[model samples]
Target: MPNIEYIITAEFHIDKGPSLVFQYPHQLPGLQNLYFLPELMLPDQIHKRNEDYTLFLLYRNLNTGEFQYLYNKNNCEPDPYFLYTIVLNLTNDEYKRGSQVKSLSILTNLSFFKNFKPVMMICLDLYFKSNDHHIIKQLYKSINEKSFIISRDSLNGMEINDISLIKKLLITSILDLPINDKIYYDENFRNKILGIGKSQIINPDLFIRKDLSFNSILNFNEMNIPIRIPMINLPDTIGDYLNPTDLNFKPNLINILNSKLSSSILNNELTIYGLQTPPIIILINAILTGKKILVMSYENSSGYIIDHILLILKIITGGGILSGLLTRYNIFPIIDVSKIELLEECDSFIAGTINPFFKNNDKLWDLLYDLDLNEFIISSNIETPGDNIIKSSIISEDARFLSNLQLSIFNYNDDLTTIQLIFRRHINEIIRILLSSKNFNNNLLPNNKDLILLLEGIGYYWSSDTTKLLEISCYQLISKKFQNLLYNEKLIYNLILPNLSNELNLMIDLHYHLQSLNNVSITTKINEREIWFNILKFLISGKSLEIFLLITYLIPPNSSTSLQSSIAHNGNITIFDKNKGIELLLINLFNFDDQIKSNIIMILQELEDNFLCGWCINLFLKNNLIYEIAFNELINT
Candidate 1:
């Protein structure tokens, strides 16, 4: 069966505005709403432009007892069925009575809609010239018949890692054939690379060798055309713009993250905010907590920002490695006021809209991101509760990773690949610590251990069996073996082993403590003020005070007094960067429970008021903690 659900064509009628002229294989459901059909088929401002192409998504609710496995076998609100769409517009003066705007769309169940672009381009060109119904029927038939297949039996024996790669890329299953180190390319493209005409039909199987690009051949209209699949595909990576030969264009996590950051959406973010109070971090954390985010752009309605934010969310979720983990979240690429009813039904979503009306309605969303102003407004009705240990660890790790990125940007050393490698090593350490326990498998059900272990081992080694490690799924985003080992070695020797003050150790130690359950004592000395400050920051960030208190208790009373006096003295032991100190103190003051709030306040009082002179004071004054402190002081007076 074909993954394609429909091949639809819509156009602007001068008398009637946009109308769905033809849809092969019958009409789609939910088209009865006359307003929505046209709005969907013709996106906002689509008719005004001479030529435009947009990639947007539509969704339908899952029927009862359907896609249960896809929804993680849980009795929860099911993830909506995705309708991936690509609308291509071209203006032609041939139409006499109607508007010149004509479009062709292929609505597919697969997220790998890029593969069908070649087919769509061909069919649209043919249809515009002849306006024949046969084009749609032929296009549909060819796509379904020639679609790539991953055999069910092959999928059953596959590891979770391989399954995730397939689900993420959603195009070609590179592991389908058993050949080693082979690159799949369309036969025609291979011939083109060799600078030869289709004169001789050499065995294309021999052409497959270790190469960077994976080109899938689309058989349409007796023409064999090659379509290059991108190394990474996210919700926002709608159109095709990847070049395999570009040095910065490799299919790796670092390159992908850097490419995304270089986008106009993130460029605007970086220019407006830089390192201080980055909206990207907040955007990431909001998605992590499953908050309803509304990214509103007044001037644009083409779902561009919607795609940008969705990509950010996907990147944070480990580039679709954890896409299944996001089964609870919904994505509305572009929505109008007509979909207000749909928005109300969702408990949490990351949606985009050009409608400014959504801004006034705080009840509609938890986070309102105004693209025009580059501002984020939190709904007053929302109460962001404190994070538990697990949530804290995840968010803190994210914070540290983002902080390191900012540090790199500040130092003019934006080596994103190295940074990504280090972060992966950090995660690998955590995985190893968890796997160290012999009873880890016993913690999960018999059937679930493989999945749990696979999830745990992502970005680390592919498999325990050395023989099968080389055959692990897709190569684009998977960390290579040599790079992985080199980075891990660099992390220990350069980052961790040399400097005890490195914040990375704090996290590694915490994971070790969690796995060992306090059995592993802290033998590493914590005498330096830098280490103490890092411990305090880590504890504050993680909301983990058990270790802090335990370490303090283990220290002698005189040393504790020495540490306190050291804070007040003008020695190297004292924190000189008062701005960072105040910022850290304020965050802890606000996020810590009421029981621990007083301790944070005392720490704040110990810091100098001169620290308030920096750019962070504006943030400090906006917080309620200062007001609370002032109110208490006034009452005492």
Candidate 2:
């Protein structure tokens, strides 16, 4: 059995923004009494105009603090019908752009002494649909009972301004803005305060420690990247089908037997013949062309910087060369066409337009002749093929021609075993090239960060001694080229944040361990903290509050029971300054989808409780972290 009503009509004014009407009732008082669309629902939307807001009046009896539910003295309108509606004339355009937040007011019709002046209120918490609520608690405080006021137009005696009406309007308006911002209820209510007329309430903890050790020395905060390990199913004791194995290492010899493709084209106008294009050049061109795949290939094939250099070369050369191109293998203008005809039969054709005229000039003709160009060009020694191939085979062919022409002055070793080892093995080729570097061969490592990172990523299990070499190389990075790049306060965070766990106990250990690393780098302490800060910053921030939940597990509010608890105990007020990181964090707060912002604020509250105290509230009262960044970020978005 339910109580049903017929048409209950009431009149209001267009004050600021749009309006929403629910058939049953609205929750928030003032303009917010219209919030009952969710709890009750006489659904209708009222839009806003000229960047203003609508104010509503929910009256209360002077003697009884309860809202007067009657509308008029005659009782046709119940005492509860004392609510006033504030509306704003808004068409679709205002809805598309923004929710014009003008001033908020209480109803002015009631008769009391027209006393104190009224103060304007701004409603900001949830957009009808956005999830960001990082500042919800702050907004609630802004409209606290002690914050707002109302008076007559003449600043004389006020007509009507009820505290209950204001409080009701504020509580409901902040709780539910344009829509239900989903974040508040998530995270098990870790970051938000609950209940009114406060007494003893539920205080629940939301995290599970991944590490159980009280005195464990593992520094979880000193970790940058998540550890990736293959998980196994079942095989004697659970085997992995997810990763690598020995059986997969065998190469496809079919590729070796097939003819390799070429890049040059001996076309109508431009001619580039017998020129070997460097792999570096190909890579560089790929970068300039925005060929991501080629850039990736270059990184895997060589070092990233070297790949970058090669990419540069490619851009400089314009689609230059590839391996095993007959057109680039020193074919003179008059050389045998018959020989090239046979090469073309293999679904491959080489072209000219490759420029290395510096080497092909008469200055190198005698040198080329001495190197036996005819042998490379014709590839025909029918009767004596076997014996000649044994002495001067194609084994060192790519190297020799490249060297004699001065295209690449690479030294070639006659050791057949070494060349054979590198033929189809990328690693072996990389090692050979590394050894070929005059500096590297002399035990001098290059001070390149990208190279070191790439080497580190190769991982120890994949290559034992080589992996050790790469790790050792990282230490050498202490030289000038690195120039303390990794030491950046924000950059060093690669050391903090556990791979997949949240535990403060681990952070303490990390702090202690980082203290030990003082011998490695005097900056270890600050670096560790900096990294941890970054992780926390990211965890508690984003378009949503997912990071906050993750961060809560790291720094729990009850961290030191013996310590003085302030609201935001670790709430370093430094970021509150404009142009600082915290300012940026606040700015991003407005952009979060309702669901995400709610979750984050709720998550932060877990630690917020331990921090919430007279001092903390005092701090919040002074926490003017809002700046140009926050305002601009929201405006731009």
Highest-scoring model, lDDT: 1
> TM-scores of the models, in the given order?
0.51, 0.15
lDDT of 2 by residue, 479-512 (tens): 2111122122111111121211222212122222
How high a TM-score does candidate 2 get? 0.15
State the C-alpha lDDT per candidate. 0.43, 0.22
lDDT of 1: 0.43
Candidate 1 local lDDT, 543-626, one digit each (tens): 233222212211111112333344356332222121122333344444425533554444333321222121123234444566
For model 1, the run of ten residues with the poorest summed lDDT:
490-499
Q: In terms of TM-score, which candidate is strongest?
A: 1
Candidate 2, which segments miss by more than 4 Å at Cα?
1-476, 479-501, 504-575, 612-621, 625-637
Angstrom error of the Cα, residue 479, model 1: value is 29
